[model samples]
Target: MTNFVTKESLFELQSITNPVLAPNEQEALFIRTQMNEKENNYNAHLFHIELASGHLTQWTFGNERISSPAWSPNGKLVAFLVKRGEKQQLYLLNSRGGEAQELTTLPNGVNSFLWSPCGEKIWLTTSVKEGLAITDEEEKEDKKFPKAYVVDKMKYKADSLGLLPQNRHAQIAVVELSSKEVTAYTDAPYSHSLQGISHDGKTLVVAVNRVDNTDDVFRTPLYLVDVDTKEEIMLIEEDGYYGDAAFSFDDRYIAFGGSDQTFKNATHGHVYIYDTQSKNRQKLTEMFDVPVGDYAVGDTQQAASAPTVMWTENNDLYFQVSTEGDVRLYYATLEGAIYPASPENEHVYGYAIFKNGNRALMTVSNPTFPGELFDFDITTGERKQLTTFNAEFLANTTLSTPEAIVYPTKDGFTVHGWIMKPANYIAGEKYPLIVEVHGGPHTLYANTFFHEMQLLAAQGYGVLYVNPRGSHGYSQSFVDAVRGDYGGGDYEDIMAGLDYALANYDWIDEARLGLTGGSYGGFMTNWAVGHTTRFKAAVTQRSISNWISFNGVSDIGYYFTEWQMLADMNNVEKLWHHSPLKYAANVETPLLILHSERDFRCPIEQAEQLYITLKRMGKEVAFVRFPESDHNLSRTGIPSLRVERLAQITGWFIKYL
Candidate 1:
């Protein structure tokens, strides 16, 4: 009998995002994305969900996708981004809903946009063209540039479109809605673009990263621009990479999140607040240490760097903090008062503050639930479930809640982990155990809901996940312990965690152990199999095997490998010594390599290298590649493919373990 999970069952529920409360606070405008299995694409449209009537209306229509809907201060109009082919232009529509009028027709497209206080104009950041001059003599002299030498010296490289002309830098632009006039605000040789506009509309901030490379952390700077004259002043110098700056309502201060510099095994994110007039900046939450395991599960390279900050009407600034190995919401007063909101929630992904200041809408999930919308009241400190995406389906399915476990590492560090007992588990029956590792080698896997883990538990197998060394959510030193010792301390941490489970959990069968992970987790999975024969089966996704080849192929290859491994291609011998591929001959477990064809993050080549090497060594291995998918196949890919990927993973383990 074929046990298959279909797209309909996976995405029958709607996913909502970017919830903006109407000025009246009676309704909210949000983006509802539904999967179109026939087209194998997502259909995203604007929606207005009413609080009283429970009525929902589709606000935007047509083939183009509309997102990032921001309600005008006057509540008369809505400004959002509309995608037409490769171009993403800003458009305005009446709140009552009608035809959208195009506001700006930019060359490359807008990354982010915000409406001015008066709503007469919209400020946005877009990629702009910069011409290059080439000298015939210089072109002929250089072997690398035999033809016409074209120079585009910009801070950031333009994201490529199929055949469209590329622009290296992004600049801030202002578009007057009534006049339909567009003006370039700050156009620099190196790309500088706007990030957020203050409530007063006097100050505009932009995040400008290094143009030619991806080591943005070291080169990106946040600059302040005058909205009227477009004169730009460097607020945060082009130093360590930083982005996501949100201004307080009074424009008295600014809060931004990022790191000071990229270091080996360094994955901590710092949130800083600056006084506009005093120009004084203080880093907040330095006391709350971030664990390396948390970074391993979180989006370490990009998402972790781009933290969201918002100011409440009460003068308290709210931001996201991934402390204690869990991502949660926290609020800080302008006077340096800090407190956590909803600290009890296991995992809260996305959130939006309501206009009325009474409540906020958040996307919350735990070990059992997938993702559900919740209404959280600020004044009452109460949370109410608003929407259940898969309640009905889940009621009929057997799911197990993951139990949080604390285990001692070999080095005397107490590691945290979660274990899911098999569904309908018999009291004395032993079950196979799956050790799932998270990516980022810096992210965290908390006691939160994971559909894949639930599905494995539903299949009568125990699933175990731990915060090993190099993972985040512990102390900074503990997080940095795995740096330069990738396969050493981190390997010991996982083994120690596993040993704890084997010794404590009676239902876990040690002989039937399996392993799986993606990206950095994939790398660890590969590393784990090479180091031990305890795992009966293994599945690695978007993993890195050979650090030398990875250093040159991946988009983040140069910096990530250099920083994490504490070496570059010049240290080829050291890179190879630490790589899992070096010990491919020791593998006895049947392994499956899953990757995306267009995954620029880890690159599919990483999987191919491991597959070929394992097969050559007479080991059982299979390679699965997803077409047209990026590194975020599980979280952001087509619903159909995501379900299939999970099913394939389950099948692989069942067949072998």
Candidate 2:
């Protein structure tokens, strides 16, 4: 059969995510997202793929968006959240396949929900009533506060469910499976818990961020509550954000990750094991490295959000470590003993540790291959390749293999990067170079198989990507070097890598240089053009132009900006001095700005500001806005739109370079 490639074909490729192995370990259930080009919406369905037979079947069907498939302990029934009309309601389905039964008639909507260990109850976090104010007249008349107007956080920024104010915080609710009754648990009118529940059903841990009118952003503290007695205890309190706590199998200690902010600078995260009985917290890992390459983790030198922590049957702690340019699994004991289970390989993105503990099911990818699941034996370090998701597609395509390179920055610090040569290239032929900047200023670029880099290489462009000062996988000091000096040494590190490529590789065309990046990478691209005219063309996606404006606009703008730059919005002059928009007059390179209209993390206004400025100055500039995309447009948006985005970006480079 001839392979058909089209705009529709781009949308036809379905994505499988959040794979959870069933209790029997014979089947895996995950969320499969299908993109409908006609509607420009993604339809997510729950699917169960048989491990032994390679049989794939869809379990959920309908117009509703179904996600977060959680199997019960018995593996007979699965619980998931479905968006019906305007509200997201909880539903239960038979593991085999059948019509799902609705569990909640919540008026507002459920944000997140999980099942109890014994499958006796369901815990959910949701926003119920609109909002209420403490009024003097209503308090005196009926001893009840008057209802206030509902403020939806998702309205202004189309991509996010905005941060609800103190008056409209989300509350936790527990629904007993037998009684079919729901009870509110710790409904604070002024604060909201980030995460809920322990491994055992006895205690509930919450990350509470107190809201006040003042600009002072208080830290998120971990609070423990006894399920039966309803007694809440403060477990861990520090001067930073903390959440994503995983309980040990015996429930003796709780492992959590947190970062500290001193002055305006934020430190990398440190994993801590908290003893519930003694009320003591011990630091587990001091510097857990963030993986380079994949942007799954946000820009942080420390471990990714929700540090992958699991307790083995042998009382050993198993977690993923992404230090040293590759992602690897590491085993640690409560007594601070740590070792790698499979330290031989350089790349391991996704993993699942079974309750059986003899083997670990994982999805491994390398520089040439996309991703394939494998069953790795813990005893012998043997691996068996399982599913070949895109084997045929890969066989038909000409993929590029990245070579890792290191070069010294002007400041004497060595920076790491991966370079991809043009596919089927002639020995002496020179090719145009594309400098791909990764998104997280804190994220690293590793030697993993990247579709975009391979596509660019197929198009006859040599792709060069580098992990600058702020990138992870490096030491904490190197990652922190980019903080408060965004465009300084990071720029030098990128330039040094480019210089190394030009000096070492004779087949690189320096005159035809092109640059592109999203998020922080986009910010650096915008900054790059303003500082130098080295690149012939550039594309900046979801970029930040004005730090001063970004501080007030973004979801984590207030705290993140302060944490990154060590400066608040009050330092407007300092922020603008570092902003790319301030140097727009010196920008000579042709630029293309791509932005998601609903992006709350970076906000579309940042893109608009740069586009309008460059166009008004009579420079070659174009702006493309994705209507319903979030900050994760490339990763999780409409499939066709993602292809179009790539086409537009490459097209811009083709036209200029």
User: Per-residue alpha-carbon lDDT of model 2 for 1-657, expressed as tens digits?
Assistant: 323222233453444445677888887776656666676666777777787776877787766678677788788889988986667888888887678888877666677787887798888887644343211112132437655645443222324554343335577777778776778875566455535467668888876666544246557777887878978788777776666677877788887666666423325555678887898888777545442123333210111122356666666776666665676777777888777786533566666677656677666666676555677888798987666556666556666678888787777678878888887678889899999998777666665556677677877889999888887776667878888898888888888888899999999999999999999999999999999999999999999999998987887787778778878877877788779999999999999999998898999999999998999999889999998688987766666678888899879988998
> How high is the CA lDDT of each candidate model?
0.72, 0.73
**Candidate 1 structure quality by residue, lDDT tens digits, 539-621:** 99988899989887776677777778888888999899988899899998899999988787788888888999899888999
Q: lDDT for model 2, on a 0 to 1 scale?
A: 0.73
Top candidate by TM-score: 1
Superposed on all Cα atoms, the candidates' RMSDs to the truth, in angstroms, are: 5.2, 5.2
Give the Å shift of residue 401 in candidate 1.
1.1
